[model samples]
Target: MIRAKTILALLSLAAPAVAGDIPLAPPIDCTLGETCFIQNYVDRDPGPGAADFACGGLTYDGHKGTDFALPTEADMARGVSVLSVAPGTVKATRDGMPDIAMDRPGAPALDGRDCGNGVVVSHGEGWETQYCHLREGSVAVRKGMRVAKGTVLGQVGLSGRTEFPHVHLSVRRDGRVVDPFDPASGPATCGRAAAAPLWQNPLPYAPGGLVGAGFSTTVPGFDAVKAGLASPATLPAGAPALVLWAHAFGGRAGDAVAFEIDGPGGARIFEHRATLDRAQVRFFRAAGRRPPAGGWPDGAYRGTAQLMRGDEVLGQRTVTLRIGG
Candidate 1:
């Protein structure tokens, strides 16, 4: 969230350290670019503007942690474990915050608890890692407990001042915030050579990507797509219309989303490309048409969606739906 820097400053305590770097493992148990995605990175810009470590617009001003985000609320409900990045002792933790998006009605006030349902681990040499927005009652470790790398701390959740479900990870060395992707904390030079990343296995940077795609009987609402309920495995032949939709993140103006649907026997049913007019942190688009006069033919239908920036495809997905199967 935009306020992460403030939260980290309030939570982190100074300590001494040696010179070696603390290599980190991914803190979440999921496939990157599939089950989960990097929604934001530590804000590298020191002024009022914001930029990710790659000098991209994936982060907001004052954001101090990396956000590993789930595509839908249903994914969060199924439980995704948050793991320890390295050997450490639990320094502190908080649990019991309800899993609710901050923008929802009746959501609880943060009340200085911006790092909801979280854990702070102390890796000696003044290195500490903090995991935030864990699900209610999912915290598995306690203060003073020794833990090895990959230890399960909790499940990701929308429990803090966040609009989506994700675990916010903040790394601090000797009480100063460190960008795990780039630990040398000065103004980020976009193309400058740098030291090795902190992750044990370096993560590739993605500027923007698709989150979800599917076929529906009608244009689906953004909320339904976000809840993982917009797409069904099958639609009756008599369904009023066939719609292909996609959800995406980090879209910039001038980008385009293309949608295509192919019926049985490879017959093209519809195709359309919608262009983004402005930058959006998250967005959804749909395209479709009413059924033919004969209702429909029973077989498999394939829907493909792609996010494009000129000739380069940022992300693409193909989904199949069966009719009268």
Candidate 2:
């Protein structure tokens, strides 16, 4: 989180105001709910507890920014550009931070660089934006460089105090943190559409969503799935087991993850549902079966996964696998 005192200091060199609200553009190149998803929103709760703009549990205590997260580290390696939300001059920047999860061994102590490898742009009129957790050596703009809306600043990475690959965007006005989704900063506005959002195109709020799904010969580790190495394009007909897995985020207790597999001729081969016992930032569930006496049939197979909250489907994905065809 960017501190108010620091923001006040950074704004001292800001350019003159252009007047009116600061219209923001989508700060990332990927599509929401697909290439990327909103992992966390600004913490709207004033107490020690946390709440998102929607009065949901998609935020952490004192979280000051919106986290747009990629599904896997593979997506980060492919390079997703982080763009500027509005026209401004680059007031400050930091680069060269290693891209590593904060919880991983050998991670560096933050000291005060919580906004690791970041860029701060002065939009004037007491308004400014901060982009954090950019990839090392990826910062493209220099101090005092003018930028327009959609200008590329850097790529999202696992730098700074982050456990995942994401770009944290913080908006501020007059040195106070502002939720772009709800600038009114009132609890009454929770779950209601913002009368005027900062983004040029307002984004929809998803309580939870599927990140990715795929087929594996056996149950895979969560780390492998997150690293994009769990799913294979094809499996042998005699494989030990045929497993289908789904990765998802923003899960709450009582939410359910359902998995189904259809073999050649659309025959139902496997089906299972797992209920979450507690809220999780991200979770994965898998179901599978061992081959029968004749070994698995050689043909195409389809797998479908859904994240359900009661009868409501929060998200769903389908994957296909070819077996010795």
Candidate 3:
């Protein structure tokens, strides 16, 4: 069963991607030690005001930004360092924000400081690496102070918007963030930018679950094994409704990832096929399929996900569903 194989492949990566085995480099080198908990990063791109996004396995809306732990290395708390990814001047800094405490290992530390006390460095011409949730009052470089790449700008702290401690860092080029894991150098900038969306992915650091796998989002709280549907799951009337989020990863580009969402009556309410990105995507809304009347009647729905590697169903996931109003 090509489809069954594809489903299996996708499931294989799911646990590790969510739990971890995230890389540090081979990759790129950050000012901090080798990267760990690759699975737990949050998408805090282009610095402050940039749309925050989820980089973690789970989506914690607006809680975007990688929450690297303090040096698990000797002589340090779990997360306690903040450094520069590149050379620049302090463009902005903020401190004294409330901090949230975390008990989960590899989970973000501190509060308000998801990336720990935010710091934005101008690279001239609008290029920047927005670092955040830094140790309060520990900013070494103020606005206009020159810095070098990998410089220890400040200590990672569990301040504003954070639950654990670690450097919450990201790189921005021309007002948009580049995948820090695979950064390309160019002239920098310091332009006022629009509020960025909380990015669902930084893309540089992908969740393990995405690779060679079929994935989907349940209604806020879905039990993978249950054949349950969304409760009062509402979509804008006539608004193209696609699964909350469906992506395929590790499948090569040009390869297709297919999805079929069944409505009542065994009808294929949603079906889509698209080339997979390093991550896969099967957004059916673009296909003009809106949710059925009564917002998908209380019933059973099933989803079949297929991953094709050059016409091969390398993996797949068939999920059971139950919908109710």
Q: Estimate each model's TM-score.
A: 0.92, 0.92, 0.38
Go through the candidates in order and give each one's C-alpha lDDT. Answer: 0.87, 0.86, 0.44
For candidate 1, the TM-score is 0.92
* Candidate 1, 1-325: lDDT as tens digits: 1122311211212221225888889999999878998899999999999998778888999999999999999999999999999999999999999988889887899999998899999999889999999999999999999999999999999898988889999999889999987777786658885455788775756778789999888888888888886567888889999999999998999999999899999999999999999999889999999999988799989999988877677888889989887
Alpha carbon lDDT at 181, candidate 1: 78
- Model 1 clash pairs are none
Residue 61, candidate 3: alpha-carbon lDDT: 30
Higher-lDDT candidate among 1 and 3?
1
Worst 10 residues of 1 by lDDT: 6-15
The parts of candidate 1 lying over 4 Å away from their true place are 1-19
Best by lDDT: 1
Name the runs in model 2 displaced over 4 angstroms.
1-19, 191-193
